[model samples]
Target chain A: MTMRSNRIGLLTALLLASTGMPAYAGEQAVIIDNFAFQPAQLTVDAGTTVVWTNRDDIPHTVASGDSTLRSPPLDTGDVFRFAFTQKGTYRYFCTLHPHMQGTVIVR
Target chain B: MLDVSEGRRDALKCMLWGGAGVLWTVAGGVPKSRVLAPAMADETGDGNFSFVQISDSHIGFAKSPNMDTPGTLRAAMDQVRRVRDSARLLIHTGDVSHLSHDAQFDTAAQIIGEAGLETHYVPGEHDVLVDDGKNFFARFASGAPHGGWYSFDHRGVHFIALNNVQNLKAGGLGNLGAEQLEWLERDLRGRSASTPIVVLAHVPLWTVSQEWGWGTADASLALTYLRRFGSVTVLNGHIHQVMQKVEGSVAFHTARSTAFPQPAPGAAASPGPIKDVPAGKLRSLLGVTAVRRVQASTRLAIIDTPLGG
Candidate 1:
């Protein structure tokens, strides 16, 4: 009986670890590295806050092609966060290095 | 080494050639550029004092064409040491580091400090990427304004360093904002019109290439204030190449990078480092610029010398 309860507790801890702490609601992270966005495509629900963290040594920017969304130059370890309000596809590229591209889909 | 010939109405034609050295002479408010052998640039100007301008070090960058950025910077510094006696003051335009990391800034600072010369700096877009230039301002622009713009006077020449990288727009044109512009107008109000004004910024004050975001927005207003001066020399370093233009009394020149060279405007699909540069040609593409005060004259002559030469 005690062993079963301990196992259940372990399972609960694993589930919590996988789903993350409850304090943060609908937060997603995207990494900018190697002159390109890691996981170039991201999907999240509406009202979710998406944070872009630059890991590359060089500077980059997150700018939408249509001039809707734009970010200042991001150095290494710099973060730019935006909360999606409506559902749509957001495509972006680094204005400094335009070859680096990424996409975000809000559903 | 200048061959000055009369053009239309007192206009001088500047003939510059790759691998062929050129000397620029400005006298009596007229500009003349002469193309000679490559080594002639080192000893062309007749000036009592000279200063060097190095830009775009990009210290922490780890990429192709030039992964060892610090090594390249050290080489550039070696070139500085060679011209140490002539070029006393050093001015770095921007991009001290590839990333705004503390370590990157620290490394670049140590390397630049080895030059042992009085150095002036203005923050680049890369330097302000993290924390909005808090790290850069604290290190280089201490006691400066909130946005890190400042001015100083040296050897009868007034130097104004402006920060235009703040509050960048979607089009990538740098913004100087209203506050700085007002400050600049007031700063120049009391100065004499005969004073040789040297204005330094990270991005070109003039429009080099709007599509590449090489120009500063609202720079015309700044130029308006400088137009009164007899010799208004504008120096900048974001494009990582040598480009010059003269608009009336204002002469705009951009310096090359000490790290890597970027493709010319519209030369490539994107404006980044030239990755496919030939193995031995990298150092030749990167170098330093020197400005000298003409002897017994008020004109300031500019000499751009590459590292490889």
Candidate 2:
């Protein structure tokens, strides 16, 4: 039942991430697939929150290139959300597969 | 435009789902695979000079293909034990655990320790998930000092354990880092060119698949130091499948995972465990033997035996 229960929980989370039912004004999303970050660069407001969803079957981590942000290992359909509190450009990459990189330009 | 097939992309993918350790022989710059070990075992005369190379154990993995990782690893150890009587030792290429948990490491050590051979290990990206591989090095490479990268001589063979899973730059593949490279240069500065060298790292030194990040970024610089050696064998893991290539005096080989199997390079949409393999056919699909002959009086053989088969 652990696998089944976990799957159900994950499915619910995926629905929430994809549907964006409660999406606020300053929230964005980034998807990970094929060992690359979709939306290589994303521009969001200073107070906006960015949620990274891993669609790839493998696990990946959203880590700051300069060690500012670090996300736990996100499995398939898992999500990691971070809020950009300041106005600056932030670069992040997957710690597991560092080649998958993305940037967030906060205005 | 004409519709094409996926089979023609890379010819090597034909031998895709190889598992376990393998036997390798380098004769006149060409690598060959053999089964019988006694032919060259007589040349070395150092008791049993053959060692086993195991990779990608992935202990915490409990999905698809096979759910019981420990069971399969036990069977692999049994297979190693079958040849252990005539084996020099065992070398693990890495991916010892699926998630780098202390319990995962404990389970991996408890099972792999049953082999009773002084096993040499390198850290796969998976193993370093916890405390930058502190748990893994604490178990196998405690003497490595800092980076879990070290080298030693065994039976005239200079064996190097390199950590390519760390210092990985964004948009880059596995990296040896400038520090490890400098260490390697100094480590080989006073060595003889005639010596036989075996390199163990978690990631493949050669670029097996660029899109998948299956290769190392700074491997070329490290290869320059090794190119001078008369005979060099590089063993790696993290790809979860067997792939081999030979260049000049160097032969690079990747072994199978005792836990699960991954798709061939570009054979699927992405790289991960091949979850759809038929239930019982899992082990055999992951078992492929590689054999090699060394003309430098090394006479070393590696057997990749998946005991379940």
Candidate 3:
């Protein structure tokens, strides 16, 4: 009876460990190049991570319309990541080239 | 001596003379020159007129595309002279020089003077580089506001020259501060709503993308004052490209640079001199627009012409 009780306790602990796993633990990479953002429009779940990688030699930045959520100017091979906790559409562009535009949709 | 005819004969003669005098009076009422003048003037009158709009001359720039900046400016001047009529006036929107250098100003003045028309200038970012725009103020202070915004009447049209480069915020949009706004309100108070209003500034009034610093910080305020005018034309230069927007009664136009062409808003990796084009194509890349105003009417017809053409 004691052996059977210990077996049951160990089984329950293993189930909880797998079921309570955290979401979005890894970073999602976005590549910027040729004056455009790859996957110009991105859709991600809430609490997901988004990363921007500058593939071009020139400098670029990601600035929102309201001047909120500004990423530091990224040089070649530099990366910037932001984790989305809320659901909304965020539009951004490279400050160096006001025309280089992209949109990230957080679901 | 008054001639009196014999009773009946004198009376008849007087009546005939009176009738002939009335006929002569009627004929003489219309001048002989009036009959011939319209026909004579019609043959020689082409009735075509044009003016010059030069922006972003950037004379002191030492970049590769336009190392000898004055040379390109001279080219623009040549284009102006070749197209300009005798009645043309030169209107420089802003950025007359790149570095606000004394020699640059001097050279620019000499080159522009060659056009032989009275030149009007508004200050640009580069022009106000020294001491909150002291250098530009010293030279162009007359008839301008504290920051170099001014208005004048020419050929029955009202031209308001604004200084947007001074005290400009991060984005390139122009600002008409409180004092200037008050002055503008008063200056435009007495004018009729039908008056053709032309507002010239260095930066674009409309939002031309804020990320790249291509738009004005406080343009909506100034635009509110201009909305009452019927034919409002806003001309600007800073982004170094020809982009036009017509909103309600106002038409906003941005002229290209006489120096070098920056890349299209989002076409390049970043905004800078686009060196990919051939050297000879540079002149073709930049051009001017000729604005013609109709007499006794507020209508304006604009024709965009390339430099070589």
Candidate 4:
């Protein structure tokens, strides 16, 4: 599901439970689709692993703007996982479709 | 022209029945392309010398539709050998490997070497998956610009090899960037517009299907540099299919893959190895062959034949 869809699901779940839900910890995912990343920007804790899954049918790659990180061509269903160990905002885009940008703010 | 249309119609009919590839002959600045069965291979090329174009050899690709990509690539090389004597040069449009691993490049080199023909290469997006094509340039000719785009002259034809795959822009479109565009302007400066200019790159310089990111974003700027040319042929191989388009003096062609075939533009949910073509017919759509004729003309005659008969 897309990030919006997941958010809606979470909201529904929280409403149904009537209890304050705990925040997600340590792991996050970015979905690649329609030449854009779902949840174009993300925030996570330091030492969290961000997994980018290609939901689109075409191939895409995750690459850092400063040329520090890159992933091989990720065909449909392929997943690229990276661990952000430091507290900084990591910006990246699909090398194949540069317009598709995303960010992960590690706090 | 009517006869050629009929020929294409017949070729399309043949394609439905599993016959693939076209034979082209150019003379007096006019190009004639025809589709011939492998049985009619003898009719394919009649030229002083012809060159081979093979594209999208995704060596590390291990997916459905095709599992043994190297085997299929080897078969493609065999087809190249079949016409090696008549074809003097082999130009691989791009995507020499699925990933730009050293071993993948080595395997591609070994298989392509079997053809025993001099080969020229450009980078495909897959081939540049690592270090922005550093490993790819290291294996091939080094003199190209930092991004591996260059041009050369051969047999009275000025072949301009471009690197559109690098530095992709928004919308997943390929980019030639300013540096390459400047070089292209200077490269074409003062050259006779009448010269037959062949531009080679990985993605289609012309917009084929924008939704799939098959086109180059800055291709129009680069093409503007060649507007004065009498005949311009742009060849590319990212979409993994044989598609042709003609715009005034420029002719654009994209080649099929030796690894696997992707859906036609907007034909599938998204583009990847088409998971399920009829088992045997898959080979019919994926292969390479060449056709040419010698003449002092500025037009390009392209012939694409599948690796299998």
Pick the lDDT winner.
2
User: Against the true structure, whose TM-score is highest?
Assistant: 2
Off by over 4 Å in 2: A1-26, A38-41, A76-78, B1-19, B23-48, B278-309
Cα error, candidate 3, residue B178 (Å) = 1.6
Please write out the lDDT profile of model 2 over residues A17-95, one tens digit for every residue. Answer: 6975332337798999877788989988667899999887677898987788888888778899998888798998888
Off by over 4 Å in 1: A1-58, A63-107, B1-47, B279-309
Task: For model 4 chain A, give the 10-residue run with minimal summed lDDT.
Answer: A16-25
Between prediction 3 and prediction 4, the one with superior DockQ is: 4
Worst 10-residue lDDT window for candidate 1 chain B reads B8-17
Candidate 4 lDDT, B1-309, residue by residue in tens: 357765544333323322222333344443343333334444435564456677887787765555566766775665566665666777888888877889989999998898788888998888887776898998875777676878898766788999887777544688889999999999999998777888899889977778777788888998888877877777788876776666667777777677766777667655655655663564454333334322333344433324221
Report model 4's chain A TM-score: 0.74
For model 2, residues B1-309, the per-residue Cα lDDT tens digits are 522343232111212332245443333433344432222342323353567777888778765555567766776676666666656678889988877888888998998899898889999888888677788898889889788899998777789999999878887899998889999999999899977788999899989888878899989999999988988888888877666666777777777777766777767876766766653454355333434443433322333323222
lDDT of 1 by residue, B100-198 (tens): 889989998998899898888998878887767899999998968787999998777788999988776544577799999999999999889988777
DockQ of each: 0.11, 0.41, 0.06, 0.31
Against the reference, the lDDT scores of all candidates come to 0.70, 0.73, 0.61, 0.71
TM-score of chain A of 3: 0.75
Tens-digit lDDT string for candidate 3 (B12-41): 222111111000000111100011110122
Tens digit of per-residue lDDT, candidate 4, span A1-107? 69999999888878745753324446788898866788899988666788999887557888886766688788789999888877787788888766567888887
Q: Which pairs clash inside model 4?
A: A97-B172, A99-B170, B21-B304, B287-B307
lDDT of 4 at B32: 40
Which residue pairs overlap in candidate 3's backbone?
B173-B215, B173-B216
RMSD, model 4, all Cα superposed?
9.3
- Grade the docking of candidate 4: acceptable
